[model samples]
Target: MDVRLARKYTVKLSFEEIRLPPFEDILILGKKCPQGRIGVFRSFDFLVPNEFESYEVEDKSVEAVFINKRVLKKINNEKIIEILQERVFPYVSESEIIKVDFKMTIFYDFIEGEL
Candidate 1:
């Protein structure tokens, strides 16, 4: 006999904190500056089992996509566990995560006339 698995659902990205700059800045030439330049940076992306819309089905199952080992190292297992406990547990039922997938990317700024 063969068993069929349930379909997986897509969920919105959830994070502990989504920090965005409140204001934009303009740089003046020939002026002393404390910082070189201002830009937006993504600090972290926290994922919890409960947050997934399909948590009911995905629970007790491990699925993940990873980017790079460096990025993975940045997020310690302890921190991930803490985040899951604090943010995911309250919403999801008890379940085991057997797999995880990670994705990583690097971005750069561009200027006119420059490749």
Candidate 2:
């Protein structure tokens, strides 16, 4: 699966807020600031990104810059659930989660063999 940084939200989490029980990968969709690359991180080890802010899709700043951005070539929804909860859903209301799901474009991880 391949997901683009369609729209982002004001949702943000700090290392303090990020819990660690059944730890798993988080679905990060956007450009990593400073270095600048459309990528994803399974774990947040002091990684901050730019673009993709605001669950209200249109409110995000992705499209024009990262349009057709290439992300991880492989993905597992079941795995990123924890990341979404701690980092994503917390900022938005319980009701808005469903709406966020509708707008995203799912992408997958990339490997060197194909290239």
Candidate 3:
């Protein structure tokens, strides 16, 4: 059996006046900072192309909506929180983070059927 694991990190920012753009939109802005790289995924709509063809190439434009999104690597959670607290806290006044979600996906192939 062979298996693979994948993980993705996403952060959602909400403001009182929709001041903060959607994650995808932010990624398109191409904002640069010492923090990280930020990018947005334009279309969430899904469609099946050439459903009858097994090897047909599908052409679609998944526009990079916002390029302002930033990414920080090799940093601990505590440090991230600290940085957010210091830099973001000042700008956001009594703001609320509606949700924080994490997802992990696993792909596996069985050499001889079900394990």
Candidate 4:
């Protein structure tokens, strides 16, 4: 029997306003910092696509955020965004965060074996 799973995630975060460098150039995030930052010796490994847009929402608390809605389909790897809340959310500072919300939709397809 084969099982297939499809998952979609929409993660929205609101934080203190900060100006980020434009995507025209590669951003070496956390490579060098004075202190209290993720200043690891190794270069950071995250790719920001040029297609992102900065939005102006009605809420005023948000400064900068990434509103990503993605769909992932796999045979066994069903939990994509669920794991991120553990690995990623820890890096966010409480003082900088205004709101964090997730919208998830899942679909399951079951196949029966033939006699």
TM-score head-to-head 1 vs 4, winner? 4
Give per-residue CA lDDT, model 4, range 4-115, as digits (tens).
4565679998887553322221111221223212221111223334322222222222223333223222211124323434544445443343223334556869867899
> What's the true lDDT of residue 11 in model 1?
88
Q: What's the lDDT of the predicted structure labeled candidate 2? A: 0.31
What is candidate 4's local distance difference test score? 0.32
Q: Compute each candidate's TM-score over C-alphas.
A: 0.23, 0.22, 0.23, 0.24
lDDT of 2 at 34: 30
Q: State residue 31's C-alpha deviation in candidate 4, in Å.
A: 25
Q: Which of candidates 2 and 4 is the stronger one according to lDDT?
A: 4
Model 4, backbone clash pairs (residues 3+ apart or across chains), number: 0
Better of 2 and 3 by TM-score: 3
* Per-residue lDDT of model 1, residues 11-77, tens digit only: 8996675422221111111111222112111111232212121111122322221122343454554
Give lDDT: candidate 3, residue 113: 57
Using alpha carbons, what is the TM-score of model 4? Answer: 0.24
- Candidate 4, run of 10 with poorest lDDT: 24-33
Off by over 4 Å in 2: 1-73, 97-115
Q: Return the TM-score for candidate 3, rounded to 2 decimals.
A: 0.23
